[model samples]
Target: MLKVNTENSVRYKGKPKKTSVNAGRLKLIERNKEKPDVARIEKPTTILRGMRLIDPNEVNKNMICSNCRKQLAFNHIVEEKTTGFHHIWTMKCDTCFTLTKCHSSKSHFNDGHLYYDANTAAVLGAVHSGAGCNALRKIAMRIDMPVLSQETYKRYEREIGSLIEEAAKDSCQGAAAEEQNLVVEHIDTLRDKL
Candidate 1:
């Protein structure tokens, strides 16, 4: 049923004997092999064609460390191609390394690609300032900047419109409070005069 060699190696029925290599030596060899790959960070093995470059420092500034509440340090950009191609910027906290900022260059809702530049922000601002989609489309014709489609613009508005409305309502509430205080002061003065 089983065969035993002179070296005490066992072989099962019709099965070849298993060869053993020292686990420690195998791990050492693997570590040696990985060193060169780790050293060559300039030439990343995973390369993405037509990947857009974004300012790492700008992204770092926007990211906050979840652990220490400090700014996150930009580590690198990685391109992912699952449903669609997208660039993800990886960041981590320098002090504790507890916080991670994994930002994607594509909208999660499939509205469009990420836009960080002032020109794109300005176009979005115009939309936020009550400009209609048709008007923005006409403006896009006059300008060289790529304007988002009316459908995409509507999606963007739907995604962030609640936040904008909340901020506006907060501002209005503060203004109303101030106005109420001023009116109460005037009423008090009038009562004193009476």
Candidate 2:
């Protein structure tokens, strides 16, 4: 017969023995415990309507040189061109001498060239609201904002006017079809009753 100690049995379970904590790790834990828990929140990008005037300093602060990986200051930027509210900036990286072109607004390829979405929207809104170019110019002047030229507005109007007309026709046709279907349904109900 094998003699076994019941107190030191293989199946005996007890509280785990505490291991010696490293002084450096213990100090780090204590330091972390003293500090307040901070929740980091990220800024959200939202699709904005109307217009917003952004400071040049803000734009400069956000701009980084692609080649040198350095922030491009306002002095390093050269104003290349301005198309309505859209502005083209040519940045010369001082360290690498690399020329980088940046646009204030995104451009869509329309026709043979590029067109700013803001300019198109402005024209469309003006036409739809019956405000016209004059009213838009007046509003822009009052706000000290860049006004779209009458000629450019006219060009966009010409391009978008046809599309608006086509959309209106489509809407009318759909409405007529729906009306006819309702009439047919009503006639079928009367015939069923008779």
Candidate 3:
């Protein structure tokens, strides 16, 4: 067995241990330690520019900032068409740089490819409300909005169905376990009475 007390010391079987620091190396390290440049220090405000403003409506045309309640100006128009069309009017609040999006209608935007974006919350709402794919399609058609394929609606249904099934199973298991504990206690009390 071998024991070494120095941090730089190393030992091997049947070999002598060596530990030393070169004087020239220490001088070289000291010479290379330079102070950071004062000019390179970043201003904190530069980072704040990348943050999103509190009011999203500030991006729309002639809209008031939802936060500051100040009138905003139209920045520009973002028009694009894929399945349908989109004419998005952008506005910004000069005070806080809050952006807001303005569309022609809440149901549909300027004949865009799709009627609504159908975010997670909206899709889950439709599933919970029992709105079938055909019903959704009919509603879109009635509103003159571009309708998505039945497959998309089916996919949403499947996703929501699985989540519901999982929650139901978990609840059933929890109830069963609680009931079993209660039944065991009741049986024990009846046996004592006998």
Predicted structure 1, TM vs. truth: 0.38
All models, RMSD in angstroms: 16.5, 20.7, 24.0
**Count of residue pairs whose backbone atoms collide, per candidate:** 0, 0, 17
The TM-score between candidate 2 and the true structure equals 0.58
Question: TM-score of each candidate?
Answer: 0.38, 0.58, 0.37
Supply candidate 3's per-residue lDDT for 28: 68
**Model 3: per-residue lDDT, tens digit, 52-101?**
21224423433666557776543322222222222334545667766655
Model 1: residues with Cα > 4 Å off, grouped in runs: 1-123, 192-194
C-alpha lDDT of candidate 2 relative to the true structure: 0.69
- Model 2 clash count equals 0
Candidate 1 lDDT, 37-63, residue by residue in tens: 555666644433433334455545556
Q: What order do you get sorting by lDDT, best first?
A: 2, 1, 3
Against the true structure, candidate 1 has what lDDT? 0.54
- Which residue pairs in candidate 1 have backbone atoms (N, alpha carbon, C) closer than 3 angstroms, thus clashing? none
Badly placed stretches (over 4 Å) of model 3 are 1-75, 81-117, 143-145, 188-194
lDDT (Cα, tens digit) per residue for candidate 2, span 1-194: 97655543333135332233344556888997887445533333232334544445535554678788887764666544656665556777889988777555455464668554667777888999999999988987787667789998898889898889999999999999999999787997878889
